[model samples]
Target chain A: MADPGPDDALFVNEVRGGDQKAFEAFYRRHEAVVYRTALALVRDEMTAEEVVTDTFLRAHAARERLDPARSPVPWLQRIAVNLSLNHLRRRRLGIEALPEVAAWPDEAATVPEAAAERRETTAALARGIERLPAQMRAVVVLRFVHDASLAEIAETLECPVGTVKSRLHNALRLLRDDLRRDFETAQPGTQPLAAPDLGEMGESIG
Target chain B: MTGWPDLARFILGRRAGGDPADECAIHRPRLAELVDERALGGTQADDAATTAALDHLWACAECQHEIADLLLVVAGLQRLGGTVNRLEPPPGGWRRLSRRLAAPRPRGALRLRVAGLVVVPILAALLVAPALVRDLGTSAAGAVDAATRDAATVAVPVAVTHAAALQRAFDIGDGAQADPAAQAVEVVPRGPLPDGIEPDGSAFLPGVAVPPMPAVIPQ
Candidate 1:
């Protein structure tokens, strides 16, 4: 994670000093990112909500231990990610059910044909992202989704930068191949069908 | 915009006609390397190595397509944050956290709470079980005694006139055993059971069966 901004740092210090308003302000600033990051990993709304609750609750409980110099985003994000992963493990959901194909809504400005193609591509990408393993998905979300740098992701995940790179490479490689397979074999006009054996992709990527 | 569209068009265009099997084998990993660097917004590849990889990427149409596809994928991934934030927990979700914070926290509160849960149920069962069991036993005994009495007192042969009635009354076959005469004794009710009569059946006597009665309707 990047360093916390001066105002955010100040809030952390204030929260350590028992300022409820400062904590609330800090929450308001970072909650959306934390929630979005959790939803990306867990992909369930209610579980993600619980993750948000737990993440902030933990941050508040350990307020004195939080360093004002560090960006609280990574700290909060790591908690949400861990909790979301644990939720998935407890469910033994093994692999998630892929999202249903998104409809290509008609828009006035763009050509229907182009819009449909883009929509299909977007849906495929979304599904591919969803299919990544929990840890790989976390790396992808931090790197690609939130635009975290390699060093920042390493700091957040508490892994080596090389590990983050390998995971990202493996994740993108599988996602690209999966999406490519879908596009190649898809019925030309309809939504892409769910392919079987995502486990096979995981092995090949690994 | 120029490189972006050109990249998209060439990628989405027809694959270059050839035996892709061998060429794909060689370039796929290299393209993966370039794309990984590009995806991370930087390349660990030094300038010379970077230049050589880009040269090979431009020269190979398959590599171009792979790089193009990955770049598009990166764009889509970058958009995910915005798209996903659409599902952000609705405003004031913090109210739950705020409520939790406002609640008092004593050390070991969680352990105390869990222990309370386990202990309370066991304690309750200990306190309440005997009375509950006694009440239930008395009600069951009274029902059986009343049913057996009603079955025996009817003047008609129970199997003939009241098989259904007896079954309904005693939940058995005709309320008759093989030696019905020996088991049953005719009890003449001195009168209709007196109103407000309550049976205290706590006292047990051998060879004297006291018909269990219903609770008194207190006057």
Candidate 2:
């Protein structure tokens, strides 16, 4: 809670030496962020927890490879995100459905009406995101949710910053248009407009 | 002068918490005011700003509403971050792993004890049985050889007695030839004789003739 301090580096170094207490210290320090990041991607508490566990377990196994001189938090977070995405991708294939937005802990969605609206909006957002091409969704998610800088996103996605910006622009436009169409259709007494297909949307955005 | 669209783009591009250039800095507060007035439409109810500069968003109604909407989207995206399940370590997870690592190995002495239980008798039999059997067989064979030697020594007298009796019956006198007297004495008749006559002719005849005998002994 006191921001892990410089002690985290010492603990991580000890963890590399197979120190259980050091490993426990590391787990306690970063579990919340790791869990939150994983939960966002996978939308399931169990899967997110698994991702956190796996990320830590892997970090523990490869502790020697971790730079003891650096902050391990970001490195650990990166592992959790990558693992969570892979899990979501596999789950998506198994269900043959779009990835669902992860639900928050029971306490986060307190009011029933508010919860229901969040769920509906989340579902719509997931479908809209799923409809986007994979690269565009990555840029959008990184830019919007993670608040990653263009360079950081580009680095994460292994693409040029120009490409990241272009994709972000196109993805945001598509999302705005999709949400607008959905909003209109959900309103009373309005004739539903034909939603533009993904290719047409991409072309229009381009 | 830059158009409103260019100004909006430049304002949107401005990094939060970063220092902007002098020309952009002059327009920054006015740009924030315009954004507060026009950009979010009429969705936000209050337009009052607490600070003279653009930093009072936490209390401003218009700013709060816009920020809330962005935060809502951010919150929704944040929900999409990774979901975590709270796992307490499997009960005794560490204890179990520790127990496995700390368990004592079977000592060499214990292994030898087990080997003794399994192998000592087999090894003893291997060492002792062959020697015992060889000793028994050697003693039995020696006894057999002694009995055979005794039998050979006793057989010589019996064989000599048999030879002497054979010589006396033939009346052989220290030679291999048969005795002439013994040859001349006919032990059996050469021809058919009467049934009541004794072939030796010591003469107890019973009314039947004896056959004539030849006097010369055949050469």
Candidate 3:
């Protein structure tokens, strides 16, 4: 017989029945995405863990009404992303901004086939991604990190797609320039233009 | 006179449906124009031109929304674009999926199809692994951050493989148990989301039938 409810829905129902065990089970099942979203947004390990704990707490408190038919990841993400952004805003007001951390998770160990130059390029891009403004960082995370669609990102951020587009493009362009400089610095052999060439001078005179 | 931005916007059109790849190539000339021939010919970046173009790109809000396809290819943006925001999940023994499967599939309106497909199998894999101690079909060298990996390894449980065991841990964990100092914290004053109106899921789950997930989704 086909069970109409999926695993997530079953977990949701179990939690709704006031089973704390099921709730813990629910956290176990979904914590990865929720924590990943938070880490991507906040770029700090400690804060991301805190967000995960808080998200589950809120989920537990609201367990009575969670829709058992749906996957709970989105709800968890909304809460996590919201909390992560709040921390960023709060930190900005009370303290000097921390040196930008890469929005990308470190891949030195994950990418086995990465060549020397590929690793260098990714490092430069990661630095650029970290340096992007917080809001722009959010757009990039939602798009690249979570793989959310443009409209999905807009809905999550409570903004228009145009705004998301602007942020993403600006973010990419900045990364491009940052990567360009990385190459420029890496390529020590290339010489700078020193003097006007006679060929250029004759052409200009003509 | 129509400015560069106005012209670009007219050409790029509005991609509210989220298919932005078609317009990706249009912005390359703009990026290429920024770097000198040396940078173009794989020699060196002209400091003055590269700086000016980057400056213009920063100042130009219009250029910000557009993608340069050539730049994406040459700068290896396509390879990094999908995983840019991804970080390692807290140690729970789940392996990161292959990068190709993990890449964002921007081809269709249903953005979740690819990602959702990637997720379902992982969930199924975990559930089926009655003894989920080892990383499945993945390399052993996954621990990227030594501090976090080493510290969390002993503190957190090895892994929670099933919903059946959701009991013992619950009594010890009701929000306040997270920290001794957090006992006074109040529950967040929020209600459940309205029925059938899930945040990212509403767009796909109800309407499109992902037949594969339904079959393997464990109870």
Better of 1 and 2 by TM-score: 1
lDDT of 2 at B218: 35
Judged by DockQ, which candidate is best?
1
Best by TM-score: 1
> Which lDDT tens digits does candidate 2 get at residues B1-219?
379986765666554533344334443454333332221121322223212223433224444433333334334444543222222322333343344335554355445554564366555644553443233212342222333323322332322222322433344235434334432322233332333323334343445576666653332
RMSD of each: 16.9, 37.0, 26.1
lDDT of 2 at B32: 39
Q: Count the backbone clashes (under 3 Å) in each candidate.
A: 0, 18, 2
Q: Of the candidates shown, which would achieve the greatest lDDT relative to the real structure?
A: 1
Candidate 3 lDDT tens digits, A1-206:
01223687888888899876676677667777777677767767767777777777667668887888765665677777788878888878876355355445545556777767566666676667666788887776666556667766776677897898777766766776675566668785652212212122112212
The weakest ten consecutive residues by lDDT in model 3 chain B span B179-188
Interface RMSD of each: 9.1, 11.5, 13.5
> Which 10 residues in a row give candidate 1 chain B its minimum summed lDDT?
B195-204
Among incorrect, acceptable, medium and high, the docking class of model 3 is incorrect
Off by over 4 Å in 3: A1-5, A94-104, A181-206, B2-88, B91-219
Q: Write the per-residue lDDT of candidate 2 for residues A48-158, one digit (tens) a residue.
A: 667777787677668888777876765776677688778767765785344354344342344344555566555566657656765676565555445466666666566
- Candidate 1: pairs in clash: none
lDDT of 1 by residue, A1-206 (tens): 33467687788889889899988988888888887777777766666777898899998988898888877888888888888888767756555443343211122223344455565776777778767788998898888657789988988899999999999988877887877777877865643422222222123222
Q: Order the candidates by DockQ, highest first.
A: 1, 3, 2
User: C-alpha displacement of B168 in model 1, angstroms?
Assistant: 54
